[model samples]
Target: MISIWIYATLFLGFMVLAARSDARDLRISNRLTLTMAASGLAAVGLLGGGAAALLVAAATGAATLAIAWVLFEFGWLGGGDVKLAGAAAIWLGPEATLAFVLATTVFGAVLAVLLLVLSRWDMMLEMVGSHWRTRLTADTISVPYALAMAPAGVLAILARFPDLF
Candidate 1:
């Protein structure tokens, strides 16, 4: 149980860092995604249900990847976002995966609204830094949806390790 807590903490920490990076650079590193996926597998294995967990994780990841690929083809999401979401889904499993998706969808909408409002104010945009200002103001830039992804991942982790509260 304690080990699970530790794993959950680590997972949440990395997720927060990924969200920060995505917010700042619009990119989620493959290294971070891989680490998250590995940690999730390790944690699941520790639960004494390694085989079933692995299968569930694999299936969830494949499903997420398929959905993400379609979204990517439609130019709605970036490759990094796809990879990050798929990796996180391995941790979330089937039960909580739907919650993660719903959470991400809600947060994405909120982020879009906030960015839209921020883009309207020159002073606010300038304060966000030149790179972000340009992206926020650009007509074609994609939102760093990983910000929402991280929070959803954390929520799913919390659902699994409820006692962490």
Candidate 2:
């Protein structure tokens, strides 16, 4: 329980890097998320119950690496987002990851809708459309979506896995 605060601080440090960096090379988000997942468990383990925490830590680490290779590299999603999500999983563990993912998906969808609704079509065209016009246009990145969804995921995990807490 107290360990959750430590994990949150670590995650926040990652966010600071993401906000400060002007380029994509830093991979601030990806690494941060991964750290959150792996360390979150280990920290809990420090409170005792080593076996489950270590198992989750290992599995989440592997999954984070795979995600980095695919999603982050492909630019489908940011590295920080990937890493942060994984870290949150460390706190939630395997059984809760699913619910957390579902929460993230739904939260992301709502955010996307909100962004679309807030902007007029003409403005949208000017912003996203121009980028889309380019054959290799990168999708518009939303730090808030990732940041906001992470905690929501954590809550979702907690809700689903009360025993873990």
Measured against the true structure, the TM-scores of the candidates, in listed sequence, are 0.90, 0.59
Candidate 1 ranges beyond 4 A from true positions:
none
- Per-residue lDDT tens digits of candidate 1, residues 83-109? 887887877787777788888999888
What are the per-residue Cα lDDT tens digits for candidate 2 across 1-165?
455555545544544454344133324545555555555666657745678767865686567547644866776566566665666556555666667667767766786566555343445556654433331232453434454454565565466446545
Best model number under lDDT: 1
Model 1 CA lDDT for position 131 = 86
lDDT, candidate 1, residue 109?
89
In order, the Cα lDDT scores of the candidates are 0.81, 0.55
Candidate 1 worst ten-residue window by lDDT? 1-10
Number of backbone-clashing residue pairs for each candidate, in the order shown: 0, 9
